[model samples]
Target: METYDKIGINYNKTRKVDQRIASIIEENLQPKGINLKLLDVGAGTGNYSNFFSSKGYNVTALEPSEIMLAQASHNNNIKWIKGSAEDIDIQDNFFDGVFSVLASHHFNNLQLAISEINRTLKSKHFAVIFNADPSLVSKKSWLFDYFEIVFEKAISKYINIESFKSLIQSTANTHVKIIDYPLPDNLTDNFFASGWKKPSLYLDQTFISGISPLASLETNTLNLIQERLENDLKNGTWNNKYGQILEENHFDDGYRFLIWQKP
Candidate 1:
């Protein structure tokens, strides 16, 4: 809880579920024509859990941080549980499906976590939504130039795409499919990458801190980067250089949808 508690306060206040992202997640869940019991690994505040529940699937939203889990909405269809990805407390082979979105990086032990995900899932149908490979971060990110240190440190924590595939494959004998997910024009999640099109959102102190990587930066460094970004936006330097990002509806910022199933 040390890791998540540091940044879980007021999480739901800034992080709202984006329908566009939700639609993609729903698609990846691959409903099997009936009510399914799904487990949301590292579920922050039951956003996705509630989404699945609304669609008639029984959802269990697991989060280790009490502060974050407390923010979740109370729904009869969705059960909120206190747990961690590395060691899930649920019974073995219980869930019809398991899904983890933007939460893998938080796992203390990646292999153990995947093993638990595999153990809990009743079958091979599972999805893990991970942020894009570190190498692809700079390709379309505006923060790379302004907050290199923050982004670099953040990238170090992410499990490489290939490495993730190997881990999942070893844990479960299933065919893994990786798909790129681009930032939508009106992305509502407010994560670090969600602000690519709306640069000003990055300058907001509260908004930036809500993102783990950016929040991990020293206060002095964070302030300096914010100042620089603010000045650039006001002086038109941001638009003059990265103006093209505004023209595009979506940018590929290293988000990938990993779906696995038995062949």
Candidate 2:
């Protein structure tokens, strides 16, 4: 069974598509052409796939977990396929473009996945939205203070941005243009770092369960983190150290858009 099959029960509740991020995805892929044939790799819950389909693009939503795909919206415009990125069943050069959001870390083999992406993509460009290495970002995030183990696990899983770019270029002969995506205070999609400003959201199991690192934690660790955070918030210790972040409307919590295009 896929990992999400166990942990993704409440995924759609909090993992809704943020329009700001969706608009950026649309804008970047727009140049490909109207009604282009697109593929959404690792299409969790099909949020972005449904978004693109609603915009008139013919989208093929590929996912490995049946549980995740089961939650996808019923859309005639999307053809949902059960598959992994390392071995896409599609034919060579089958898609006009492809995109994946916050799903690459779950891939069993990054190199095979990139090769498969390149093999199936006929167009010059594809987009991926991934987090910066947790090691670097954790230093600036209060989340590390509360859930140190979560960040430690994430650091082992997330690829370094520079190394990721190099891997893509080597595998696909594509140029990578990275754009920084700062988290908005009112971000609708409650991703892992989305609670940078509103720390209380992390205390909610429903909210944190949607995030892989947090969801993967043992019950004892989760309880300990919660207890510490609750204590800090009650005693103003959290505010004392990280309260200044509340003044900012947006934070560069190390989310980035990596646009890979053939030069």
Candidate 3:
């Protein structure tokens, strides 16, 4: 959880919401001056929460990281609380809308989190975005090959998309429908694409350090990824093999977004 706080500080340095994805989410939002109340669970450093709040929505950010929560409180003009996906204590049927990002993979009890989300949002017209994806080990790439060799660990938190979907369905009442939303257009400009395009030499060392591996895994595993990245860049090995990543328009990773709506 504390790793998120480090992420919060480093977040804006590298993380900005993509405009195209924002457009999709924004379309489903309550129009301006409508005074919609919302919650951003696991809203570390108020990434998307900051954007929603800035748009005049009454957004409350709930996060468990004390350092991240503190920074979120200080940096944003929104309500900040200390909490996790499980055991969220807000009143039932309170928020008009709710959202979370990237944090679902960390949820140890997915059903409880889903139940809490369903319990807290208004009975009808509530919408959410989630994902069902597998825990992946990169075997095809030269970079990840080095990673697997050095770091004897895995990154996926038992990635099981079907199981994740079932957990949400079991907890949610009949009113909720889980639908797959198209990948947001700006995800690339915001995260992977922008970096993959820049020469590895141009990337910041600190930004690289902020990326987290699965908590259940070993830290030594990262050494493989790190060592390989360092070695390949120096030896011109990576550039020769995967230089196209910089020019690539889009790529897919394991994670995908699922939208839950109350109808």
Candidate 3 regions with alpha-carbon error over 4 angstroms: 5-12, 28-33, 73-77, 130-138, 141-143, 146-158, 174-203, 214-224
Q: What's the lDDT for residue 81 in model 3?
A: 78
In angstroms, give how far residue 198 of model 3 lies from its true place: 4.5
| Candidate 1 off by > 4 Å | 139-141
lDDT of 3 by residue, 148-216 (tens): 432233344444666666666666744333444333323532332234344352235545533444222
Q: How does model 3 score by TM-score?
A: 0.78
For model 2, what is the alpha-carbon lDDT of residue 4? Answer: 90
Quantify all predictions' global Cα lDDT against the true fold. 0.78, 0.82, 0.59
**Clashes in each model (backbone N, CA, C under 3 Å)?**
1, 0, 3
> What lDDT is obtained when candidate 2 is compared to the true structure?
0.82
Question: Best-fitting candidate, measured by TM-score?
Answer: 2
Q: Which candidate should be chosen as best, given lDDT against the real structure? A: 2
